[model samples]
Target: MIGFMPMLSKELRELGSSLKILYIPIVFTLLTIMQPVTLKMLPTLLKDASNLPEGTIIQIPDPSVIDVMGSLLPKFGSLGSIIIILIIMGEIAGERASGVMAMVFAKPISYVGYFAAKLIAGSLLVIVSLFAGMIISSYYTEIMFDKVDWLDAMLGTLLYVPYILMTVAITLCCSAFMKSQVGAGGVAFVLYLVLTMVPQYLGSFFRKVSPSHLVDTASNVIMGVADTHIVAPLVGTLVLCSVFIAAGMLLLRRQEV
Candidate 1:
């Protein structure tokens, strides 16, 4: 953990300088807000559709506030994950390519500090962005649709944090191992897909334990239908994140850079 604080401060400073602190939250806010906005406007948009038949009777039902709030996680699960991959793909690989990592290592920083700094910085950016987006979206949904439980909204979003953290961990792990940023991104994206998709088809137990299941669990929490199986996936996702971080540190230690 030598140089952990300095490395973390450096990472945070770099994040601010790169404008990632500004744009990432803006993107998350837009993505989350779009859910309620679209739901609210669906009836009007469908009623005025140009492609519909002249006498078409569209009967779109208005979605409840719970349903609208529940929809936010899926959008984040898909597009938000991709955005994260793109943002972090080059963090290690690009730095290594430019010899920045080597230069940083020339200092007194330990591999744990270096890897943890990247992971924490990335996770902080994403989690803060998500919190901003969810809070604003919940406020907008309350105004546009109906009242929502603040406790449910915040708790649901908190439950989803581990999954997002795992994504950052996996991406950093990929970046640490690969020499090319594109290769790191591609591999991380594939691993993301596998971690999210393959478990459901494996078995019922696998589905319940998968990191992707947390998205559904979070949605259920928002909708007030959550079951007692929450701890399993939560712990499992955290363990998986630790595994990836350790893998990254190991891989990084073996490399020259």
Candidate 2:
């Protein structure tokens, strides 16, 4: 626990030096803001661009706050997932490949502490970025559309965070085994797709088990739907994250570095 702080600080410093600390927020913020603004302006933009007759009208429905907020899940689930996987795929593998791990561990250090630090740091960054985007999105959504219930929106967004953490854990596990960042990224991406997308084609059982359920649960909150049973997916995600963390620690300990 004592060593976790410095290790976490090192991870944070690395993120800052790499400019991810600045740009990740920018990317997420844009993603959040883009949907509402574009939806709000779509009629005008389409009408202006179209070469239709003067009497022609572009009839577009005004999106509700729920629609606007609901759209964000898919945006984050797809692009945000990819970006995070790319950023974190190198967390441990790169260090090991570049001999940084050896140098760092030449002194007395806790392997479990190192692994915990990386997971917590990466997860923290993801949670912060996601919630920040959600907050901005909520504000914009209220202005452009109807007002969303703040408590529900906040609860839904918070519920969605474990899914992101699960992705980070998978990336860390892949990083523990792969020698290169590309390899780790590829493995993590494939696994993530399998976990989040392939389930869609399977039976209802698969839907219940997959991390994809997290999105559904969150959407229920955003849509003001009742009886969104989140316990199964939430528990599944926590278990997967724990398993991945344990696997990463085991793999890292066995590596020659």
Candidate 3:
């Protein structure tokens, strides 16, 4: 792990210089806040946009604060995943292409350190952005609906972090071995779909154990459901993240860069 801290600082500096530090949080915040705002305004929006006959009424009920908060994870899961892939898909592949990897490796850094730095930096960016968005969205949800429990919101967000971490690990793993950034992004996206979606068809057990299940667990947490079933999905997600990080490091070490 030689030069790990310096390497991490470099990665974070690059992210800031690239303005990902500015826009990612904004995008995620918008993605999260939109859920509650749209839900709150749905009835009015529908009524205004409709071409219905005169005196026709759209009577959609407003969602509760719990429901609004519970809906955030699914929104983040789909769009936020794509945003993460786009941001990290080029982290390794682009460096390798531009000969930056060779320059960086010329230092006393171990491949493990380099890989770990990338993983941590990317994960930090996404995790911070997610929490920023969640906090702001929670505030808006409370304002538009009812009061939200801070403890529940924070715990639910914490539970959802593993999914985001797994996303970074998978993207970096693809970037480490693939020569093309676009190819890495595509493959990562496909793998993301497979990992999140395929388990459902396999069995209830698989579905419950998959990383995607963590989103459901987080949603349940926000909704105040008292289930002890969170352990499997949480452990499964962390283990999956470790497997990908190890694989990425192994693949990176084999490369000429």
Report the lDDT tens digits of candidate 2 across residue range 157-220. 8888888998999999999888998999999999888888887789887778678898889878
Decreasing TM-score order of the candidates: 3, 1, 2
TM for every model, in the order presented, reads 0.96, 0.94, 0.97
Q: What tens digits encode model 3's per-residue C-alpha lDDT throughout 1-257?
A: 98899999999998899898889999999999999999989988888898889899788877878889899988878889999999999999999999988898998999999988999899999999999999999998998999999899999999999999998999999999999999999999999999999988998888888988999999989878786479999988898899999999999998787
Compared with the true structure, model 3 gives a TM-score of 0.97
Clashes of each: 0, 0, 0
lDDT of 2: 0.85
Q: Any runs in candidate 1 off by more than 4 Å, and if so which?
A: 53-56
Write candidate 1's Cα lDDT for 166-216 as tens digits.
899999999999999999999999999999899989998888889988898
lDDT of candidates 1 onward, in order: 0.91, 0.85, 0.91
Off by over 4 Å in 3: none
| lDDT of residue 87 for candidate 3 | 92
Task: Give the candidate number with the greatest TM-score.
Answer: 3
- Badly placed stretches (over 4 Å) of model 2 are none
Worst 10-residue lDDT window for candidate 1 reads: 226-235
Question: Residue 221 deviation, candidate 3, in Å?
Answer: 0.5
